[model samples]
Target chain A: MEPIAVISIFVLAVFVGFEVVSKVSSTLHTPLMSGANAIHGVILVGAIIVADHSSTNLELGLAVAAIVLATINMVGGFVVTDRMLEMFKGKK
Target chain B: MSRTLYDLIGLAAGVAFILALKGLSHPKTARRGNMIGAFGATLATIVVFFFVVAPKTGVAHALPLHHLGWILGAMAVGLAIGVPAARKVQMTQMPQLVALFNGVGGGAAALVAIVEYLHLGSGATKAEVIFTVFTVIVGCVSFSGSIITFMKLQELMTTRPVIFPAGRFIIAATLVSVIGVGGWVVAALGTTPLLILAGLSLLFGVLFVLPVGGADVPIVISLLNAFTGLTVAASGYVLDSVLLIIAGTLVGASGTILTRLMAEAMGRSLFGTLFGAFTAKPQAATGAAEERPVRSGSPDDVAILLNYARRVVIVPGFGLAVAQAQHTVRELADLMISKGIDVAYGIHPVAGRMPGHMNVLLAEANVPYDQLEEMDEINPTFSQTDVAIVIGANDVVNPAAENTPGCPIYGMPILQVANAANVIFLKRSMRPGFAGIENELLYDPKTMLLFGDAKASLTKVVSALKAL
Candidate 1:
């Protein structure tokens, strides 16, 4: 939880991201992008955390909206990516 | 749940996220990779709910069920909208669909930050306030920018760049005010300034993308995708969640790299795309008037050419998607192949708005993967090709990129379809492509223009070949 430790982890993750993602062929770039889009939908966890702990009605309302948006982002992102990948057939 | 158990779940989710990215690196494993990623997302969501919220233990000293109903209701709403859209959307609209999904994610991050800021109630640590404010600004920009892109792609608005005389001045002023108000919110901890910051950021997003032409949308959308990732990362910093930090950083870094690659493919840099005043470059006088006559043909003529050709290459573009001609083109290829002619498709790296967009369309039409050749691989064989068929494609095959200096797309790699003995173009008009520039390849004596709807033209050609 130390700032230095967190920053270090972030820096390492950046290299890992570039390393893993750069290997994707240009032909798969769209799906790669869509898949990355889904991964960031992990922010839905943040929305749920805020919504659950919300004290006031206004804060609760905003958090619930956030949850809905994030959920759509997550579900739609993954499903669309799957649909795209399914169409990627091998040489017949 | 104990703190140790919570951290354990986060760790497992992080590993799953990495595996998901790994799976996506190759087509053979991409579908399974997506499933693994989705599983990780579900696990992370459930873990946060149970480990952080539902438990009676730990730091949360208040009621947990107050907004539970609203949260579930919102989730149902997301499913209602997202599942069907993902299921039924035609493949042609994939770019806008991705943009819309990206917008929602961004809006969610911004909203989450706002709620957290309110909950802090002026007593939060400086780091927390700073991170939360960062999320609010970036997320709002990504959200609004993505929606504008969606509208353009969907044709609710013009796909052409909307530039005005004082556009740059207005954008500069709005950006300055956004930063000023954002600084005020951080120093004073006032919700009012924060609200103003969000509004200005949304406006800034609209202005930011308005001047960019359609040819640049893929890079803009990819960059916005990275922005959403950074927003999520900032929210993670606000919440001090390690899993969120790792996952967000991964997307942020990868999206940035992809954006750079897309830009390079178009021979433009990210700096130019953002700040360059790309007001509609005039449509060049195509030299069609001075040049030797361009051969024009009917569908029957094209059918006869294909029927006699020993080898053929098909280059597809966004026009193919617009005309929904993939299936018809596939039938034509099949007919040619049945006559013992070799047929191959040339795929440009940044073709058809999104990466691999043409390949996905071709796959839908049951075009074999091996027959889909990349630009580098197919360019060399064009000289040996008896007939090069360009279906609704122009910019990618344009010779201007290699031959003409001062042209916008100069020095960019292009398909060498011009090298073929005979080139057949299926086009709607003499109007330029998404890049808003004329293609010199159209005027080549060896090129024959087949002007009509791509599907109707291909269908006619198919029938003509059948009659033969």
Candidate 2:
């Protein structure tokens, strides 16, 4: 990727990130934070990508561990956020 | 998969994430928004198995989709552990659980960066090396900082701010060394320098979270969440994945905004919450040991006050969550509503360890949404209420937040329950709140105390109200 392209994407995403959650109610703060926590779990892609190329035993071991941890962060995060939001769904 | 197709799918995943975040900001769309985020993340992870980042020339490092068995098995293990933990965790413990998960995510980002850095070796471009160093440092800090927060929230450690002599200088020096070593790694590009950088960052993370008292842990957690997001973005740059970059940046952006908003809601400066303890004035010793006479009342007295009140505001705090008394409080609220008393719950933004935590717990106990009023909404209504019942809560209702300048909790917004015609507190003991500051409202002449476990007291009050 070009440096200019990466910078452009980075700057634009920052504005989008700021714009999305600016109006959220405090009632949903926990879930929103948790949900954002889960979104970063997408770093699992970086883990898997690095794990695929690990030529040595040490590198492979660390990458695999990263994979496991990222999965937990992602899967567990969404599930918990859902559980938190479950109560809101049940509200009449 | 062809490179074009792969990049196209990645773009789609990124767009899905934006929509997910947008959906989560509104009440009606939150659950479905989370579902969309889950879907997008799953899609991205699975797509990795099919497509690969093109390897640069002479880099025989990663064969396409290598170690497929290990990757699948590891994910399964993650699933086995994550599902039950998320499902079975009690609502009262949600804050710690969130902290724990955030830590692991951060750890994962750091590990991924390390592996990628080693794989790149000296062949990495200057920009790539800088991003790798950034990822490694921030990820490590976020990882360890989150663990400290988890311990504090779990009561595995003291919840009070840990301030030692010259603590500010020590923290500042650690931060300086972390940067110095980070520069060494970027210039020298060795495994040892990077590893040392990681270690220092981890130390900084622990030290950084230690001085934050319990009441402000939520803000720290949110800020660390942003740190982890930036790490993911750095990792995305290292791996050259637009999906990772966009998703990470979004979290980074949103987490930063959310942290600021939570601080504003609590009437705290962002800098004050993070570094205030270093320069804090030692609060005067509380008179907790003096055994001052408080007007202790029976459950019948609480019941009588509630039975005749035209309007009632119930204030809840961390102790209520600690005692798992959300259900009991809801039962009492329902009972009050049945008696035709105008009932409302004054919910502080920072209530129950995390923002919005009480609302989730109360909702679980079937408390109606409309009855749960946020701090901004309910602060003014207290003056019109006949009885203000505070159940297992202290800091949120403490007037010291407004009156005392040097108290740890001073300047934080508090429920103005003092304006009510009567104040009733059901507390376990006379101990000060999490900030280790005494609450003057408790000693008010109009305040009535009913001491016991929150659940038991609420139950007794429910029965007393029933007898009426």
Candidate 3:
């Protein structure tokens, strides 16, 4: 990927991020935050890539732990956020 | 999959996340939004095993990756631990649970960066090394800072601000050392400087969270969440993963917005919240709190007040959640409504342990959404309210926020319960609220205090109201 392309993606994403959650009420702040948290768990891709190519024992071990932690972050984050939003059933 | 196809799938996943954030913001679309996000994440994670990023120039190298079994087993281990914990966590413990998840994500990002750095060795580009250094420091800081927040919310440590002597100076020094060490890592590559950089970042993280307490906690958590997002972005740049960069940057941007909104809702400035301990005056008046005379009342007295009021407003707080009295409180609200009293709940923006936490608890107990009024909506109605029942809450209703100068909670907004004709507090004791500040409302002439567990007192009041 070109440096210019990456920078363009980052800059465009920032505007989108601000616009999307701007209208959310305080009532949904927790879920919104947790959802965003889970998205970053996409870091697992980077972890797997690193772990796949790790040549040394130390590197492999650390990368493996990263995978585990990233999994928990992504999985727990989404599940917990879902549990929270479930309680926000529409008014009876 | 070919590289172009893989990148295109990653683009689709990024689009899913955008929809997820957009959906999670509103109550009507929340659940579906979450599912969409989960789908995208699953897609991204599964797609990774099909190809790998070549170490030197960020090219796609076809899989199968080495240690394939280890990666699968590790992910399995993560699932085993994460699923049950998320499933079993009580609503009251949700904040700390979120904190814990955030911490691990940050730690993972840090570890991943370290591996990439070591794998690249001296072949790492100057730009890549700088990104690695950024990820290492911010990731470690977020990891450790979140742990302290976890401990604070879980009651493993005191919830009050843990300010120490010359705390600001120490915090400043740590910041300097972290940056200094970071510069060293970028200037010359070595395992030692990187490890030292990680250590200093962890220490800075702890020092950073120690002085933040009270309603400001959620703000810190949100800020750290943002920190982790940026760290992931830096890691993306280091690994040359376009998918990671997009997802991480989006989170970083949205988390920053959320943090700002949280601070604004609490009537606080982010700068003040982070440094208020050093600049604000110490609360030296708590000792005098025990000596003040409060109008101690019986459950019967509380019942009489509620029964007579034409309009009643209930203010729920952390204490309500602590006693797990949401259902009982709802019952009392139903009883009042049946009596033809205008009943509504006064929910502070920063009520309970976090923003919107009380709503989750109340919603869990099946309270109607229409009856729950946010701080701005309910603030004006208090003057017209005949009886204001404050159940296990303090700081949100405290007057010190408006009247006092130099107190820790002075600039924060609070409920105007003092304007009500009668104010009733059902409390456990004379202890101050979570911010460790005394409430002057308890000493007001029109105020009444009922001493007991919030649930028990509400139950007794219900029976008395029934008898009446």
lDDT of each residue in A44-72, candidate 2, tens digit only: 89888888878798899999999999999
CAPRI-style docking class of model 1 based on DockQ: medium
Residue range B312-369, candidate 3, lDDT tens digits: 9999998998999999999999998999999999999878788888888899999999
Task: Please identify which of the two predictions, 1 or 2, would achieve the higher lDDT against the true structure.
Answer: 2
Per-prediction CA RMSD (Å): 2.6, 1.5, 1.3
Best by TM-score: 3
Across residues B1-468, which tens digit of lDDT does each residue of candidate 2 receive? 777888788888888889999999998999999999999999998888887675432443343578888888888988888889999999889989889899999999999999988888887889888998899889999999999999998889999999888888999999999999999998999999999999999999999999998999999999999989999988888787988889999999999999999998888999999988976788766665436677889999999999999999999887887888888998998899999999999999878888888888888888788888888889888889899999878888899999999777889999999999999998999987877778788878999999999999999999999999
The top-ranked prediction according to DockQ is 2
Model 3 segments more than 4 A misplaced: B57-62
Error of 3 at B171 (Å): 1.5
TM-score of each: 0.94, 0.97, 0.98
DockQ measured for candidate 3? 0.86
Instruction: Write model 1 residue lDDT over B350-392, tens digit each, in one string.
Output: 6787777888878888888888899889988988999999988
Tens digits of per-residue lDDT, candidate 1, A15-66, equal 8888887766788888988999988988998898888767788899999889
Candidate 3, position B67, lDDT: 90
10 residues in a row with least lDDT, candidate 2 chain B: B55-64
Task: Name the 10 consecutive residues with the lowest summed lDDT in model 1 chain B.
Answer: B54-63
